[model samples]
Target: MTSPQSRKVSEPDAVKLPREIKVLVAAAFLIAIGFGIVAPVLPQFAQSFDVSVAAAAVVVSAFAFTRLVFAPLSGWLVERMGERRTYILGILIVGASSAACAFAGNYWQLLLFRGLGGIGSTMFTVAAMGLLIRMAPPKARGRVSSLYSGSFLLGNIAGPAVGGLLAGLGMQLPFLVYAAALLLVAILVATFLPAAIPVPVHERGQAALKKNILPLREALGLPAYRAVLTSGFANGWSAFGIRMALVPLFATAALGAGPEVAGISLAVFAIGTGVALTFSGKLADTWGRKPMILSGLAVNGVAMGVLGFTGNEFWFFLVSAIAGLGSGLMGPAQQATVADVIGNDRSGGKVLATFQMSSDLGAIIGPIAAGFLVDEFSYGVAFLMATAVAAVSFLFWLPAKDPHP
Candidate 1:
């Protein structure tokens, strides 16, 4: 029996998202769906050129390699061109690259085209991060990050199924479909996303816009930022690197399962992640980013540590889902922490790019290191190493200041 004013103060904002956020989320969904469409077919398409397995693998790696290499330049573009223009340009570049990939006359042509698309990928990715930071309310950054990430996750889940069906028609069809989807996203953003709102000059007469741009070195000096970088790397290592590369092989080798079972386990992991995403954002907003991030790292770490020891399918899937839950629980919080550090008024494309690089670097290195461990020692050792990496990240956060308070 609270009064209306008091009741209002206690309640959360309406569930509705801002129009700008909605547009971006929709754009994210389409972009994810398009990427998903291309993924299932890319390796197979390369193989169709009568290349060896290693060569086909190279085609897959080329995209990631280019992304890593071009990330800094993408950050520069975000600063120079403004988020809206950079985003639209990036979409068009990727769309054009996709179209080019569809019509590649040889293996090298496909490889080159795919690599070009990676440049565009980083461009849009950095711009999107900047836009989200600028537009999301300080209190609601966690929710916004979750929504943005969830759209991508859902699209990724749906994309492969559609890609698989499209493959029956032709390997190149998926690329064309993906290209068309990117075009749609570009048009949508161009039509709906407004230009940047101008900032007022500071009290001392310094240009507010210049003050808003956060330099990379300055960001690196913040303990919270440093802690976030570690978590980003660990998350990339375990979630993107190990999960994608090793899980399927582990299922087949250890559990004597088929490809179908591996697929099911992976899907279940995503299901776990989706369930966590439903509530993690709200928790991050209310409870603070630090607790959620640490908890997530611990849960994910333990789940991974035990993953290699599962004796059968039931245990395997259970741990996989648990690991996914851990990852999901932290995803929003990790993002919100970065947002907190950058604040809503400041431009942080460089900071965001560096953060992304940590993850990307981990993704590149984790599988290679884990694979070596598997070859020399065992799967147990490999997974344990992943656990160790996560632990190190947790420790890094221990002494760092929490941005929430």
Candidate 2:
């Protein structure tokens, strides 16, 4: 198999992108904004339906479940329809579903709409990534990946504050705001995005769909691809799941901080992540991916260990910052590594879809596992478990060489 670098040498035109890259990145920013607007409010909205905390969490879990199931299929759809059309359709679906979510009268209704939103998200996300990998040059891939990751982090940072403010207006107000954002996203996508020429009719009509389903073994056999998936899983597990599960509980119960204090702690952690990512992409490009991945895992391990011991609010925030920094360092490397592995193959779409599925899977599993450990033992046990997972990821990186090299 040709390496991504070698492929770049052979086909120079593959590195030269059309002007649509900016539009795709803008779509990513908009999607993140929509998601962020809902994240902080969804649980409260679910609870208004008289659901339990775990049940309310199902609102999130349902979204992940649908994304996990549909992500791979999205690749096939993008191949059949072309990237631009798929992206526009996805954003429209998300907008419509989010709008419906605002009017949902029952828990099941909300769950249904959120699941639909997840399907939309999967299509948009996979197609956008395919566009990015196809358009960016290998030399600039790291920076592009970092900027892509940062856009979402920026959205995340802004979303919660916005969501909190909107929540003050009414419980359903945030959903309305998210719907509006999605509408804007859909409009931007449709207006600014040019059509991605479909593969030749003969090429796509018979061969494309058949080629869409890359065997899991074959996909996983690619070392760089596997590494990115592993890193993505570790990231989502630690960053999204475990952090959300442990941080607030630890702040409120162990540190005796009020809700406002705990919320600020979370915000500070996200700020650290966003700030660290600003430079992390450039570092990965200059220093190479291995050091960034290994060092990030190590920092994440130490940060989790620190959280296991610290009960002070300030200390908790400090440890969270370290963990966020670790995530910032790793996230861009993981994305670039995926492109490195898949290169310019049409498989880029499927490869990224599979890679992203791992994160979704980890997001689904991490909190449940951590919550069980916490319930069975203590929050200390949960943090220790997270530390162990980080440690395992570090070990995974030890023998792993960067394929991009």
Q: Which structure among the candidates has the greatest lDDT?
A: 1
Give per-residue lDDT, candidate 1, residue 199.
Answer: 30
Q: How close is candidate 2 to the true structure, as a TM-score?
A: 0.88
Model 1, residue 387: distance off in Å is 0.6
Off by over 4 Å in 2: 1-19, 197-216
User: Candidate 2, residues 226-315: lDDT per residue as tens digits?
Assistant: 666777788788888778777887788888888877778777778778877888777776677778887777787678767867967778
Off by over 4 Å in 1: 1-16, 198-211
Tens-place lDDT digits, model 1, residues 38-134:
9989999999899998899889888888888899988888878888898999899999999999999999999999999999998999889888877
lDDT of 1: 0.87
Candidate RMSDs in order:
2.6, 5.3
